[model samples]
Target chain A: MLAAARQLLVREGPGAITHQRVAQEAGVGRATAYRHWPQPDQLLLDAMGGADLPLFKDPSAPIRTWLHRQLRQMADELEVRAVAAMALTLAHSALWDPAIAHRQAESVRTIIERILVATRSAVASGELETEISAVDVAAMLVGPIVYRTTMQQGTVADDLIDRLLDSIGTWRD
Target chain B: MLAAARQLLVREGPGAITHQRVAQEAGVGRATAYRHWPQPDQLLLDAMGGADLPLFKDPSAPIRTWLHRQLRQMADELEVRAVAAMALTLAHSALWDPAIAHRQAESVRTIIERILVATRSAVASGELETEISAVDVAAMLVGPIVYRTTMQQGTVADDLIDRLLDSIGTWRD
Candidate 1:
C-alpha cells in the first residue's frame, strides 16, 4: 500500500495523492488505506523511509574508490533527473515546513558522517597524507556530485568520477 | 516596475502576479504595465535576470577572490531558509513546465561559464595548476555552496569558502 502510494506520488505528484486514489491504485479497500495512513504526507514519508534499500558496504575499500562506486550506484538507482527534480521540490517545500527541513538537514549530516567514517579508516591505514577533518572532505566530495546532478541536468558519468578520484587520490600521503 | 513585480512574485508567489496588482504595486496604470510587458512570464523572467538591478560587478578581482565574494554574497542574500524554500518550489514547478526547465538549465550554464572564465584567468597567471580543467574546478566551487544552502539549510560561511580555496590552492603542478 505504501509502495503504491509512493508510485502515485512520484508519477502524478503530491496533489494527485489521496486516500481514494491510493486505494484504487493499490487494489485495497478505501477503508483499509485510510486505516493505515490517514494522511498522504504520512504515507509518502513512510514510503521514503521504509524501502529496504542496500546499505553502505564494508569500510575496507579505498575511500575514493568506495565513494565513487557509492555515488554511481545512487545516481543510477535514483535516476539523476528524478533526484534532481525531487530535490528541488523538497528544497522549496522545506522552507515552510520545519519537519521537512529537519529531515533534509539530518540526511545531509548522515551522508557526511558516512564519508567521515570512510576517511578515518583510510587515515588509520596511512593511505592519505593530509590530515584534513572528515567534515571538510565530505563537503568536497559532495560539491561536485550535487553541482553536476542539479545544475548540469545529467548524471555524474563514471569517467568524471574517475577523474575526481585521480585528482583527490594524489593528496594521499 | 520589474522590481515591483519581482517583490510581488517573491512575497505572494507566481499566482498573484496579475497585471492590475503589479501596476498598483509599481504605481503605474494597468494599461502601462500591459503595454510594457504583454506577458507575465516575460516580466518574471526579466526580473529574475537581474535586468533592473546593478548587481554585476567588474571582473577585475582575482578569480579566487571574486568567487569567494560571490558565494558569500549569494549565501547572505538568499539566506539559508529562503534558499531551501525557493529551491524546493522551483524544483517542483520545473518538472511540469518545459519553459521553466529550460530557463533553469541556461541559468546554471551561464553561472558555470562565468566561473570557468575566472578560473582560466587564474590558471593563465600560473596561480592555479593547468592540469585540472576550469569546468571541474567550477563544479567543485559551486556544488557545496548549493548543497549547503538548499539541503542543509546552512550558511555558506566565509570559513567554508576559505577552506575550499586552501585545498584547491595546494593542487600546484
Candidate 2:
C-alpha cells in the first residue's frame, strides 16, 4: 500500500495520492489501501518520512566541508523537477496544516542541530577560530542553500559550496 | 501617478494595483490611467523602478557594513505585512514574465555589484586578506537574507548580520 502511494505521489504529486489511485497503482483493493492509510496527506507524509535517505556521513569534518556536502545533497534532491515542485507546494500548504508545519519546522531544526553539533566539534578542535555562536554558523551555512533552492530554482554549484566553506572556515576571532 | 501606484503596491499588494484602483487612488480618471499605462504590471514595475522610493539607498559605510544595512532594511520591509506579500507575489510572477524576470535578476546583480565595489576597495586598502571573488562573497552575504525572508518569513536580526559579516570578512586570504 505504501509502495503504491509512493508511486502515485512521485508521479502525480501530493494532490493525486488518493486511496483509489494508490490501490490501482499497487494492484490492490481500494479498501486495503484505505485500511492501511486513512488520509492522503498522512500517507504522503509517511512515505516521505519512511524513505531510506542518506544520513549525515562526515560528522567530524570541518564545519564548512560538512555543510557543503549536506547542502549539495539537499540541493540535488530539491533540483529534481518533480520533487522541487512538490516541495514548494508542500511548503506553501504547510501554512495551513499545523501537522505539516510542525513537521517541516522539525525537519529544518534537525538539519540546523546537525550543523551546530559539527560546529561545536570544530570549535573544540580549535579548527574554527571565532567568537561566533554555533547556531549562527549553522544558520549561515543553511541560509544560502535554502535561498538558492527555493528562490533560484536550481542546485547550488560545487564552486558555490567551496566558496561557502572557505568563507566560514576563515572566520577570525 | 507613479507615487500613487507605488502606494497602492506597497500597501495593498500586486492584485490591488489595478488600473481602476490606481486611477482612483491617484485622483485621475480610469481612461486616463489606462491611456497612460495600459498594463498594471508595467505601472507597478515603473513605480518600483522610480527613484523616490526608499528601496534604493546609497550607503556611505564600508562594503560589509553597507551590505548588512541594506539587508536589514530589506528585512524590515519584509516584516511589513503588505509589502512582504507584494514583493513575494512579484517574485513568483517573475517566473512567467520575461521582462520581470530580467528586472529581478538585474536587481540582484546590482546589489551584488555594490558589494563587489566595497570588497575591491577593502582589498586595495589592505583591510581584507583573502583573494575570494567578490561575486561569491556577494552571494554568501545576500543568500542568507533572501532565504530568511522568503523561506523562514523571519527578519535577519542584527546578530545574524554581524555573524555573516564576520564570517565573510575572514575569507579575505
Q: Highest DockQ: which candidate?
A: 1
Ten contiguous residues minimizing lDDT sum, candidate 1 chain B: B51-60
**Which 10-residue span in candidate 2 chain B carries the lowest summed lDDT?**
B50-59
lDDT of 2 by residue, B76-143 (tens): 66665444544554565554577766776666666666667777676676666556565556666766
**Model 2: chain B TM-score vs. truth?**
0.67
Query: What are the per-residue Cα lDDT tens digits for candidate 2 across A7-108?
Result: 665554445666788788889999988888775445666666544334343485555566667767766655664455445545555555777667666665
| Model 1 C-alpha lDDT per residue in residues B13-88, reported as the tens digit of each score | 4444567898999999999989988865455555564422212234444666776777676656445353344444
- Give me candidate 2's TM-score against the actual structure: 0.65
**Candidate 2: where is the Cα deviation over 4 Å?**
A1-65, A81-87, A95-100, A124-131, A150-155, A166-173, B7-61, B81-87, B95-100, B121-130, B170-173
Worst 10 residues of 1 chain A by lDDT: A48-57
Q: lDDT (0-100) at residue B84 of candidate 1?
A: 42
List DockQ for all candidates. Answer: 0.44, 0.29
